[model samples]
Target: MKFDNDFFNTEVREGFEISSMMKRAWAAQMEVFQVVSDICNRNGIRYFADFGTLLGAVRHKGMIPWDDDIDISLMRDEYNELIRILPGELPYGFVVAGMYADCERLQNAAFVPQLRVIADEELWDFNDYMKYFHGFPYQRAGIDIFPLDYISKDKEFADMQKQIIKLGMEILGKWNELNREGSLDKFVSEFGQLCNVNIELREDTKNYIWKLIDKVSSLCYRDEADYVSSMALWIDNDSYKMRKKCFDDVIEMPFENFVVKAPKNYDEVLKAEFGDYMIPVKGTADHTYPFYGHMEQELIKQIRRVGFKGSVDEFCEEVASGRLRV
Candidate 1:
């Protein structure tokens, strides 16, 4: 888990230097990935480095100089199996969060279907924790786990499935907005008619909608399909759609100081995702660089101002209740 200072300070690109803080964040995420890898290995489940992470592994032999997050993909059934077993298997300081995982705290922070394996731990002294971890105080770091589902071979059915998923996502967004605006009754009345189901507003309404979306995304079975894609990302782009054989086997690849699992057909996968995968396209990452540093600093200041010495979950609830002034 310890990285040499030289490694931290080295420039992966000519003009881009990895800050020590960013290096620490990368280390934290690597720990999370290791934990996940171990569990999957023990349980006979398969996963592969995905998207930017896979690109980085094949091209840079480590994290991309600018990217701050790690992504991995699992087939639908294995993804579900991981979710079912992860709760009982995680180490003391780790927790899984997602609509399906039912972790309300982190789920409310970002209502997405992709499961996040977060490093959730308490920090009684924010300064000390920050000095040691060189990352966020609360939920220190995490990795995203996206589910790859089967896509129908028939073009028409596949297109229809895509449309249904798009509509489901729109409905989920509106449901969140309406619930936030205290118009749950209105949402039920309107979308209920659209979905052709009498959805009564309840504590689990959001979960109900999430399940509906997942169900629609998984209408096609893997055994009957020629291609697989990340249903959760279909709303964004079609790059994720590829031949099922691309992930049929995995090969170990160098990633920093560790060897990690990657698809044997990584060349094809990368070419599908990013044309000319070897070319460096240095640009802003999907998230702000140094991931949570700014937000964590703000939270530390707020905690100090209010003289709060409670757990991170309690602080989150206090802020959500509108009783704490940021």
Candidate 2:
């Protein structure tokens, strides 16, 4: 179909196409989860389903038909144990895909028939299955494994986690530099050590918020669910719960499988981050924004990352627009 800038607006770009890219991503994720679960069972690595995955098991008995993601949380030790043993336990087609600890380029990129590489959904070939799709890769599709850390009293812990994430991102920038110079392969290799974090200018500017998150996350923060839900709620403005009054601990609600709890003062938090949570807030209406886009987008779509209230209606005026219960 021929298109113009105005009409083409409904269509997403090459990297964000929902239909084709998502199914492949989720199918790959389930493979990883199943493989990981089997290995964990055999090797004695205890990984209980957490967040949405568990909720899905309870609510939908699988995926939340309309949803597209999964989450499983493991306490730190369990996570570490699984990580330590994962190298040898991978199923025939599954292998590690995380950027930091795994291969520089996907190790199985050429080998595996099905592998989940976390990036834009639009890049994959979705030719045959387009008609059957409802859309994939919508925050609800991928596997998000949240770490459960022990509660720590050290208030600076949050700052520390922030330090860790920021430092890690800075390092990713360094790694990208090698790619920038067409030296990605060389730089990521053991021989490519030529780099620095530009310490002088960034020493004071980097925020330590993630550290706080890590700190609070250690307790799995009672309302951690809200942390994600509230921010997600406003975009579609039509869900009943999204319009209802929120408690700091709404994260405890059972959506599909796991018990969800809210982040600290989530309502107030959403307002702080997104002004007028009820407005037909512009930009791409998805949850993988300002946060995940930090890794990809030229601009942050700032979808419902931290928290969500209702489903897809909050952002659409054609649907009911209820006031937030903060």
Candidate 3:
């Protein structure tokens, strides 16, 4: 998966240079994406470039110069199917993390229910790894998969479902906070009183809540509904809701060195998401640009301070086990 040095250092925008490190990270993300694409294609699963990734595909024919991550969206049923099959299908050193997988090493579920395809491998040095695979830090480089769930056509019911899902997420957050503070008993009591149910505290209370939210969010089947929204975003904003037909057919488009799938009517989809989307808007990103840059520096400092010679995966394990400070 080697790339030309000039390719890694090319400037996609004037005065907004894409560094070799960031480009290498993007290459790693694309590798993970290609793996998922292969699995999906072989199994008849469908997905589309989404959000900023979609924007980038349409505008730049690749990753945005400053964007550091990739996003893809799947219809709910396909999403569930992929989650069911992906774990056993990935190559060695690659695994699914985040909400569905509940990977403890990633611990990414507390924020969103989306999944991430992560590359978990050993690295002897931070700089060397960054120059190559660019996945030295555990969750540094991956593809974010968001599920698009059917939303009811009935306005009242849809609003109610959103509210219920939002409350469930809020409770899940409180549950995490209380658990972290060693106040699970208080959370259980308060949650039981709030819901008027005899809730039993369990190690998987959070998982249970997530399941409940998922059930509520997907009450409307895609075939029966006129629209779909990001299952992870509908709880907060309705703007993500779009006509189901927007994704009825997928068309292949150029993305970096690879061809990727996108919704056929991407113009309408992008217009709905970002009015006049053809015009470039810089610097307003969902995440920090160069996603793992600062963390890489800190990890390198800690490794040098301890004179650690082990692989990056081993270092992450030590940090997870409370034997090392990041």
Which model scores highest in lDDT?
A: 1
The residue-by-residue lDDT of candidate 1 on 98-168, one tens digit each, is 67655566565446767888766552244443433433344547899988889888778778777656765
Give a tens-digit lDDT track for model 3, residues 200-259. 777566665666666677678866788888766766777767899999999999988788
Please list the residue runs of candidate 2 whose C-alpha ends up more than 4 Å from where it truly belongs after superposition: 1-28, 100-102, 107-144, 170-326
lDDT string for model 2 (147-200, tens) is: 544322343643343344343344344654755687544323322122222222
List TM-score per model, in order.
0.81, 0.39, 0.80
Runs of candidate 3 with Cα error greater than 4 angstroms are 10-14, 106-110, 121-140, 174-199, 302-326
User: What is residue 23's positional error in candidate 2, in angstroms?
Assistant: 6.5
lDDT score at residue 173, model 3, on the 0-100 scale: 69
For each candidate, C-alpha RMSD in Å? 6.9, 16.0, 6.2
Instruction: Look at candidate 3 and give me any clashing residue pairs.
Output: none
1 against 2, candidate with superior lDDT: 1
Model 2 — which ten-residue stretch has the worst lDDT?
Answer: 317-326
Q: Model 3 misses residue 119 by how many Å?
A: 1.3
